[model samples]
Target: MIFRHTRLIMGTALLAVALPAVPAMAQDADEARIKKLEAEVRALQRKVFPGGDGRYFEPQIDSSAPVTTTSSSPASTTAVTDILARLDALEASLQRLTGQVEVNSNAVRDLESRLAALESGAAPAVAADNLLPDEQPLPAAAGPAPTPPPAPAASGPSAQRLAAVQAIAKPQTDDPGDDEYSYGFRLWNAGFYPEAQQQLAMFVEKYPRHPRATYGRNLLGRAYLDDGKPREAAPWFLKNYQEDRNAERAPDSLLYLAESMIALGDTNRACIALAEFGETYPAIAAGRLSNQYEANRKKVTCN
Candidate 1:
């Protein structure tokens, strides 16, 4: 669990850092080429997991058969019911992780936008070459060398356009009102999960509808994950997923939910989570889900 949480943080950071480079590096290439590559990757992923959509980034899971748990006494049944209830809570936590992943995905998009801005802002090394004036140098022999025309200065509009592009290409600014969220993230980055959780919880409450609410929830889930509380993280991740269904985070939420279930020794629900991840985000499902699926399958009770 600790390793998983660390990987999640590193992955998010890497994605955020890498996205901005795409536009800056590929500016000279045809836009069609860029889109084509993305399309090709999406297509390939979909092909790998037949019937997969390219929208979300969920992983696949095993779908062989359901296992039946035998319980005789009423107390045994009630305990089973309690386990199922815990599973429900786990599901909810995963939704929150989904939201955080979405926020990270959006950040990548924003970075891409900034890269485009950088590409567009780069001015030509030299103004349009004046062939007529430069080679001839001034026709002194032809006539009284006309006053060498002064070089034309760049227009104001061009300058303004450059400034606008540069501004747009810069990273997103921190929200002034989200001080607590900021603090929470800082603590999370520093490995203080408990303090981070408390701060993040307050941030969610104080700014329930703020733009960073999804991110806050996501961080909260991460806090739980880092604390080795996958079950607690499940509901938050799930909430994040539902709130932002199309976000990259949704599939991630599903993935973690399944993991949490497996950890709690609930193979059936884990499979259910994995299957849902594949169904909702097929493109991502097959590539990321195999290991978890196999692991859970080994523990299955049903034939």
Candidate 2:
């Protein structure tokens, strides 16, 4: 009976040892399988998101959520920042250019206004001879009155002498210094534009260096402007202004230049001319010319 009890105890001890080893083996196998599954998941993550850290088993965040930053290289980040800064600077530069353009535009508009005023407000030129005729003084009475002569008979020679005296007293048309220009000016004032143009052109050719040359040129331009032929008028105005910028008709010429430019759809040159007029003749700003400039500037929408 003792032998039988010993055999049973031995068998029980062996069985306990064997059972513990089986559990240990099972745990080792489970660890190997878990490691293999982790490796496979990492490979899948690499395939799905090539540059991402392979933490596939981790809980995922919502893709639609906003991200504050990305895992980008520092150099790349810096380059992106520099690009943004450059864009900002470029935008600022563009804004400055736009502001400068606006300033220039305003300056041009102001200049145009002044030019229009000067041109529109110029007074017509009057010839020096056209002023009041010379007044004749009455003959002074002698200290004692002379005795009156007997009345002469109305005979043939006496009548002929009287006729000659009457003819001499009649107003003469042949004033050497004042015929051509005066006639042209009269025609212009009377709205005989075609005849006036012809007369004025002839006068300009005949008396190119006369004191009234500037006035004649300006009047010729005016005739074209008034006749609605601004293209033809512009050259005359420009000529007058160029010939004698300080002459009485010079401002008139510049004014007409702007007007003709506007009429011809050459607003850019017209604006430039207008601006120059203001700069050249700052003194005209407070005169009637300024008023005329303002009116024309508004018409062109200069700014």
Winning model by TM-score: 2
lDDT of 2 by residue, 136-197 (tens): 22111111211112234663335655464334322237553357777778777877675567
Off by over 4 Å in 2: 1-177
Q: What would the per-residue lDDT of candidate 1 be over residues 158-268, giving only the tens digit for each residue?
A: 665446433432123466447767777877776767666777777776786777777887778778777886655655665665567675455666666666656656555
Per-candidate TM equals 0.37, 0.43
Once model 1 is optimally superposed onto the true structure by TM-score, how far is the C-alpha of residue 78 displaced, in angstroms?
Answer: 71
CA lDDT scores, all candidates in order? 0.57, 0.63
- What is candidate 1's TM-score against the reference? 0.37
